[model samples]
Target: MTFIAGWLPSDLNNPSNDNIAGPDSVAIKGPTGGFLVPAGATVSNIGFHSKNAVPAKFSIYAIDFTLLAETGGATTGGAGDELFPLLTDWTPQVDTYVYVAALTSSYLTGIGGDANLRFMPYASRVYEDGFPNPFVQAGTANTPKQALWLDGTLAASGPSIPEADDITDESQPVTFTLSGNENAPTGITINGEVGSNLIFVSENTGAGTETYSYEPPLIADDDTTDLVVSVDGATAATVIAYTNSYDRDQLTHPATEAEYSENSLSYPNAYATTQPYEWKVVTDANASVVTINWNALEADDGFHKDVASYATPVANGSTTVTLGVFVPETGQAYQFDRTITVSDGSVVVTGEGLWCELFRDPTEELFTELFR
Candidate 1:
């Protein structure tokens, strides 16, 4: 988050506690910080905090100052000061806790005002369930982290709790690109929270372009780009803000080898790949019943019976799939039956025993030997 401060035209050369008015002490919810007020602005009063989840009130003030115009016979006020534009004093209603007082101008660099431009000290409110506020009591050692408990309530235990979202001003989205090295593989896409995708297309023999698109369109004052990147099955990469684009600075991310490999089968002793095996299956729109037929083959393994029947089929597509089975003493795979539902748009497919599978000998003896 970027920082913005109020400006005024007071010379701080003479440290006089008697000159200022209203609450002299200021508290900030974020981090302790300081800023300078441009000339001519007066220090009025600063306030913070409110009952709303988003505090309705926040402000700051300054004192005795002169607004000197950019063009003037420079008035020398003191040893540590130079002359600037001067103006009269006035007060304006606060808006969204952020207030600015300066000569009206499209640009902020050059302007002067007499009234105090309120500075909203950073403020935040965190509410916990059951608990009245954010602070935790001293005796609650076993309390779940991030969990809220009433002051005198019984200690509760259950699932781990999550903290509330941090409140902050929404940020704007930034457009950026990434250039990959010539040796890098193409077709990479990075995703951002805003539903933007950075696609890497081989534009030339050596480089590609990464573009960003909003998922749900962005709104004004909203943080536009919370960058997220996806590679070939590895954990996604997080891109930094302000860094819109990066030249492939050496290979930091790469595709997984499993994503690039192929599966193969070979004969037992013939040392050749030749097969006339035929496999067939059938099912309704709702995968209620499924049957498979593998044409008879020379039975090398005791499981040459090739009519594979799946009471149920694997519904979800996964690069790696596993079915969990428990054997009391000797661990072994077992079959189970369950109904499954499939949906695409308005169409619905429902079938019973859709996931039942019998794990017998491998279809190929060499394939069976590899696992043993």
Candidate 2:
């Protein structure tokens, strides 16, 4: 949010009104120009100044001459300035003409009968052509004056996120786009977790479109998460995304031959020697139940029938086994194949034995056996 102070002519003074004879009689004065507030801008307060240290009441009107806001009352203290804050914030939808009327006080006669007050509207952001004049005074009596000007400190608007939609894929990382409108956001979070990979697509004077990528943890199907954007430690926008239904295609098995090749059991004693087989299943979705089926292999002792760690007996010849994996979260079953080969002690016993045998028997027959 931006802070715009004194957004109207603060130097303009109300002329003396002798018609306001007493405290009951009021002389209403307005400007001859108006200001245009930007879309989404909010008017927080209006400022008043008295050149003659006189007390007065102010009222703000819209371009249609409708009453929008007003001040209870304000008096120029020793500093000759006071702020009349609104009870509720006001946001104009279209071009608004902020008209301020200074109702005379009993001291009007004491202060040379001149109200001599200046009024300025304070708002968040101003449009490019919001203020048309630097100095504006009252035109006609109670005809809804249009004069406007701005003073005091000026600031840029806050950051914003315009897109708020659900994501389709939970397995893939998501990127959220945000607009740093004049002021860059200090931080961003997803599901209360800090986001990573913050990249700015373009930056110009602290304003640009930035992207934050986040890889969600394993979540259950149809679950939702929130991506919140914050500025100055205040939450500005929140985007919700739901995980899609679990699919069998989303699960992957990253098995390698090296994992099983090093655990091959010796022949003849293959039943006594068990080969450790642990094939992990990787997925971005939660799994309530997981089961592994070791086809054509003798299973050993383990939890859940060796779903995570499988110790199986191997034979002499090479055999292919299809492992069936089931996930209760998806209610689906998947399969993967792995081939195991056991040494019969014909050429070599182990990896060290094979290298030792190669050094002793460096012939074409040994070379062919090694390659085969």
Candidate 3:
């Protein structure tokens, strides 16, 4: 086990001073040279201490490896074997203490051995010294500073959280788009746990707004979530709504009935009318049902009254009547009389049936009967 504790100095200590000890220097002690750490070892209190006024603040830095040094080496031969380096006219300071404890398992792992070993202590400013020095050098009276040899695994770095303005008003919906400095996530998810629920509508897919319409909207540190919207392994847009709102009118409409006919007078088709009449109408939603309304009715025609009086003929049981005017199939049917009476310079028919049939080229007898 290895424990490294040190105080961060305000700046580099004065050179040529072996008795001077400041806060910025760090002391690292662990398995080095022949003194290998035991297999089952635990290291704690390994953190950075700042020499700030009032109260010193320390933060624990979780690292996988520790530093060690080798001493008493020559510039050409033993100098290269030492773990630490020696600076020009620099002296090592005291008051820096680091602890190391090896677990029983460490011995089983091959790090610990029964042979006696000797290890040297080293100090270096992490920021200036660049850790994990490849060369194992020795320290001198003038240049006693050595490289910090830290060994262990480092924590994996994770993606950063997005930052934006915080919405305080519950009624206001927060809308945002997902973006990445380089690559966007494969997919994004949004949990709508907010007041009265919120809706997100997408015009691209008619997948109207997803609603988070609960009593209290779900609070999230960040609105954007990574999600993949691509299909068939193709690229797609990353634009999505975190919170949305839409009008109710855009989703619903009133039911309506339209004009229609069964025989030759079927809907969307107009057949010749034998008598004076108005158009009939039918209406429906998603389907066409009988939709009779005042809007569907056509204006009344004077010729219709005359045709209405002609009862179903006793002989053929049907009478063919011609309409004096064009009548749409959307209103009441009318008829002109079989017995017509001339009045005011025009032959005025007594009556006509509403929505009645019209006569083709009329015969002499039919004309006489209609004119009479």
TM-score of each: 0.19, 0.34, 0.18
Name every residue pair that clashes in candidate 2: 8-149, 31-145, 31-146, 31-147, 32-146, 32-147, 33-146, 33-147, 34-146
The true-structure Cα RMSD of candidate 3 reads 25.0
Q: What TM-score does candidate 1 reach? A: 0.19
- Kindly give the stretch of ten consecutive residues in candidate 1 with the minimal lDDT sum: 144-153
RMSD to the true structure for each prediction, in A, is 23.8, 15.9, 25.0
lDDT of 2 by residue, 234-318 (tens): 5666657665433222122212222222333211111111222222223311111212333312333221221223322333444
Candidate 1 wrongly placed segments (more than 4 Å): 1-4, 7-369
- The residue-by-residue lDDT of candidate 1 on 1-372, one tens digit each, is 111222112211221222211122121111111223221123333211112122112222222123211121222222321223222222211111222222211111221221222112111111222111212112123211110100111111211111111112122333333322222222222222233333333232222333332222221112233343333323223333222111111111112222211120111111111222211111222333321121221122111111122123334321111112222123222222222232231211222121212313223443444333
- Order of the predicted models by lDDT, top scorer first: 2, 3, 1
Q: Tens-digit lDDT track for model 3 on 1-372?
A: 122232112212333223112332123232321112222222222222212111111111112223222222222221222112211211112111232221111111111242121121123211122232212323344333322222222211222222222343324654322211133323323342213432332221121112111122323223553322222234323222332211001111111112221111111112233333322122111112111122212222211122222211222122222332223322222223232332232322223232233433322223333333
Superposition TM-score, candidate 3 onto the true structure: 0.18
- Per-residue lDDT, model 1, residue 160, is 12
Instruction: Count clashing pairs, candidate 2.
Output: 9
From the highest TM-score down, the ranking of the candidates is: 2, 1, 3
